[model samples]
Target: MAVSHGHKGINFAQTTSICLNFIQEALLKHQWQRASEFLQHYFQALEDFNSQKRQVALQNIWKLGSAILYHHPKSNVETFNAFADRMKNIGVQNYLKISLQHALYLLHKGMVEEAYRNLNQAESWRYGEMSASQEKIIKLIQAYRGLLDYYTWSKKRTELSKFDMDGFATSAATQDMHSYFRQASVNLHEIIKIPGVWDPFVKSYVEMLEFYGDQDGARQVLTDYAYDNNFPSNPNAHIYLYKFLKKEKAPEDKLISVLKILHQIVPSHKIMLEFHMLLRKSKKEEHQKLGLEVLFAVLDFSGCTENITAWKYLAKYLKQIMMEKHLNWVQEGWSSRKDWWPTFHFSYYLAKKNWKENKILALEKAFTSGILLGKGCKYFMYVSKQGHKVQKKSIKTMKKFVMKHNILDSEEL
Candidate 1:
């Protein structure tokens, strides 16, 4: 059903409050499907309200837009445009942030000139001395301008532009890629010196250094970026250093050191899979255990939830670890977990060791009804041609896969 602003008693703020309350309630219960329905209803009401009226508190408007960006998976360019336009129409304070974000969206879409124009608009708002945050924004604007100039030069590499030649050296009369890179370097240099996550600026500076055959400089810059105490704890900084070292063919021990530190920081980093695979082949037992943890993580990923291969590996590994006790473990999901791990291989073993057609049908019927997982759902309809009430015990493996400290090698306590 659609809500109408024409309703005499209904208010936008009240509607927003009610809609968000229900949506959040659903989300708290891990009911994403229900939350999605509530979200759609809220947006539908918003659109209806927009047709009749556009006046609202800026905070309310911000909240409305933020719901999509933070909660919805389908947020995109058009959504951002709508959000920025809403903010701009009300002459929102800190307006440069709106332009800056819009500029980033344009850059993402490859609208380089348009993005530069947005940065220019943002920069124009500055007057007199700026605050620390404003200063950061200004530097970002200049950094983006450097990127724009570099992009322009790239398109015109062989563009017959005049050059200023010096003994065995020459510089373009107008800004070229090299000169633009230098400009980017200078703009980025000071910004990176202060400890902070300067992803874009640091990347630009490092790339410039590498292009100018300053490998040593690039290495040191990445080293400082990763290890500097002034910077917040960040895994990507270390990952950047690790990649740089790998590309430079740094020693094995050095590569391992960075990887170890990164793993200690973010154990479930996707890149750790390759390292774990090699660890699996190592002669050490501890390394082998760590290797299998990656498979567990792979299975935990949304798309890989149904991955049978990973399930099989973990089951076999579990059996190996348990030895004689493997068979003693019930084939049914009577036990909460397949050991105390983050994922279980219940499906593989359940199907293999005990697959009576009737038992499968019963399980399906249980899922489709309020008997096992609660509330009947049509999504599980295909699992059984006919569903009837079944005992909750028939269902197996609601393994609490909460990964509190999944990393095996604990930091020294």
Candidate 2:
């Protein structure tokens, strides 16, 4: 009873300071659970402070708490509950921070419905408090747009479609919708027109172009972006550019350069396999030879045991090339494997082309293997059906031969 001050004597400032120190200690020790607990008590103490100055104290607490929560990697129910409770205690005067933190927390927790609700509320409630910094407002807008972009890229189309962009524009802090659009357009224009801006800027620029239905402009931008940037150093970028050029029917030389860069990057089995497929599609004999050499080199390094898909492609390519060149050794090598039933079918195709001159008997060996009975039966029927009417006798022989090796019953076939 000497001064009769009691707990109130400590003052809100002292309580806040002590709480901050405890929070710092918990963070340093990586005790997020304990840190959230401390923040709950700290916010409660602030709520109990003098009513006249409570608004200022609440605003200060929210700012500091948000900074902490935003950077922490691991957040949980307790962390969000603490933030929500502080917002409720602070009243509507601190609504923007309250709603923003709630939205962010819900987003982190994968509760998108609740996050969208809170974001809408935050946008609606935001007042002149944000008038101090246009840059901060721009950052906030970007954050919202970034979340939209995430949903778009990740194929969450239904969720992205639910968002009301018009509503967002109406409630946004900027002067008008054109300001946002202008800023975005300018950024993307720079991305396409300037060098060294490709990495950080292409994704956004492409997205914006897509949104506006500017397909031709988007293609042009991609062309310029690829031209200004070095594609050879990055195989993935090179492939993406190559695919784009292929779709546009760009010069054969441009596509060949892509293949050359890929070959230079690594002699990996997959890359060699892709090169062979591309060369065959382009119908370039010299490139096909080079691709074949690379494929053989890869086989030497890793052997034919690995890369089953590559083996399938290589076998098909070899069958086609050997047929065109009339190489008997290639056909002999192809028949040596139990798994080359498909190659036998390819050989059947070539033999059918010159059936009278070739005297092909490989189909007899293939039918005996029973490997071509299931899926191969349908292909055999298709080829037999395509025979000339004058070769109707051969067709009949083929049909009877296929029926003998058919995997399914007569009705099923």
Candidate 3:
């Protein structure tokens, strides 16, 4: 199953497999640069191959494309599309996936008509397929179609509100409204019946319910589908539930109860952060203490996004709490991770407060982690000046590292 490239019998399939293996290994190790390099090699190796080999290459290309989408949402669109066009040229007929992506991209850019047309094309492609995979794709297409229709109706409704509608035009609008809702209901029902875990379709349905001013309906749907099961990984569903309860102004006790349930179910950094946010809304020391606990939980859950704001706020809380307790947070060595951006700031604050050698050691740990200086280098140095003088060797090393990496200076305090 090897595709021979040149007279020397270069095996493209073996090389491609090796590249994929290396990519996976790099990703597993969180070596993103290495993973990206391997992906580029895979793409290069697949170019200009025969049709038989092209299909397999396209499959791997899509795999890499999806991984890129997940890891780096703001990646180059032209490059992605170039790969996609190459895939299409190789006789891969799964245009629905491509069209849906394009539709969403267009919609995000506010090209409503183009987005609508792309969605319609995706819907048309759904008619002739009945495979298990196709069924999932069809459900997704239905969700997007319903979303597009909702957006269109909303825009038209806004425009119609400015005019004195004649009877004929009013009737036409009424008919359109009826047709839209009827189709929406059908899509919602089908999505609900699809047997599996919750997905983007479920999120879309919940959004549609919310858009139609059915807050209760949206809450019920999320509760039944998203929360009724084990810990769901969908952040949108969690946010939707929190927003609904917040809008209702649920009691503190009730909110705490729900937070406890969500925390126990997921135990991730987001839920912990949300719990802290909720506690911050309260005007009491005990609630703030609870918020501090939530911060600790955030550090405990390593799956959190690299949220600098949360870490900075957490440092402030730690300082405040330590002052009240008449203790040194620096001595406590309160750091979640040594190699994260937040750790640098946290260590800086600890060093400034204590002015101890141990604190300097902690700061050195954060500096060497290589994750600290992205946008906080100047501020880090500012805080360092407030504390004990950093070692000359350490300063020189940091200077070299910054120069090599070209981290932009941020005038943040």
Candidate 4:
């Protein structure tokens, strides 16, 4: 239900807060179905509020809509289209993102003509310098449009059963299709030059080039663009660079050198994890010591708030090395963002550390927070003798699946 300003008691902020709190609760409970239902009411409330305070509602709707889209990919097309219409009603300029989402969804469903129209509408709205986020969205739309045309033409080229009688027309269409990919390549390169777009653009650009059998060209383009700005801020670019170097058969030293530089610039979760893997794979005597340093550095850098993959490996390695000094920091980081990593995963680590006092509390907290029983039951068994009162049928099914997969010891879902 939506509250209007005309309602005697409630103000707009209270109504908005109530809606947001509802969404948050649904998300915390992993109730995507409930969240989807709440989103409809939230937008209705926004519409009612907008009827009175148009500007305020217009400014806030995009953020909430984007959040819903990001979190609820399974949201139906009707709902998504409604959101796009709302955005268009607010201002055509603000509809660019929802327009792109609509186009992509249509394209995925093989609605080519409708997707093309949506893309054209998005393209027509381009005018001035936009926010970094908006520019990224625009670039994505352009890249998708180009790639879609190329794929559509390729499909046409393959279905040449009737082309025997109209050879000239078929050949002309083939040439046009080739031109589509070529034009797309050029457009993607231009998009790559835009700030905040380089990382994503490079992935698609490189994929396009490699798909056309120009691996060397793709590597060079990625390298040139990534290194052009010496102080690289995007961690994915570095990760991509490392991947390119590895594929090219570069030596371990060269890979390590690049990772060293990458870690200096943007030591993100994936990057740190990759660097840790490379160190372990190299397996030199000093590599172990160096890897531990890098692992501790990652804890310091990110506060252990991200990268459970790295944390798992680090925890196992610490067990091997018999290290105990930095364990406190590890615990701190894991506990800080219990929502991101499974509470059982962290609790398992705590159990191993002989931190029995915190282990049960963490398990109870995770249990109360609604972590899936199937995902955490094994860890719970390790730290506590008493079961979590999980359904017997669910536990039996989980055990069968775990035994079949031979991952009974794994902490990940």
Best-matching candidate per lDDT? 4
Q: What TM-score against the true fold does each predicted structure earn? A: 0.52, 0.38, 0.52, 0.50
Q: Per-residue CA lDDT of candidate 4, range 154-230, in tens?
A: 56556654457567877787677667668667767776666553665577668767767898888887676657675
RMSD values, in order shown: 13.9, 15.7, 13.1, 13.1
lDDT of 2 by residue, 306-369 (tens): 3445544554555455446534333233333426544543345533543343322323322222
Q: Each model's C-alpha lDDT?
A: 0.56, 0.53, 0.58, 0.60
The lDDT, on a scale of 0 to 1, for candidate 4 is 0.60
The sequence of per-residue lDDT tens digits that candidate 1 reaches over residues 175-202 is 4556666665776787788777778777
Relative to the true structure, candidate 1 reaches a TM of: 0.52
Cα-based lDDT at residue 269, candidate 4: 56
Deviation of model 3 at 19, angstroms: 13
| Winner on lDDT (2 vs 4) | 4
Using TM-score as the yardstick, the better of models 2 and 4 is 4
Preferred candidate (TM-score higher): 1 or 2: 1
Candidate 4 accuracy as TM-score = 0.50
Report the C-alpha lDDT of model 3 over 1-413, residue by residue, as the tens digit: 22223436546666677777877887788666667766767775556457757666666766666566446635555655565555545543556666677667666667778777767766766344467776677687777777666666556666767888789988888678657666766676576665455555566566667767887887787666646555445545555566567777967766665676666556664657768777767777667666766665565554542344456556555445544652323223323342454543444454444334344444443342222343244444543344334455654554455444322232220
Model 4 regions lying over 4 Å from their true place = 1-53, 59-83, 104-113, 125-140, 147-177, 197-200, 211-216, 228-232, 262-413
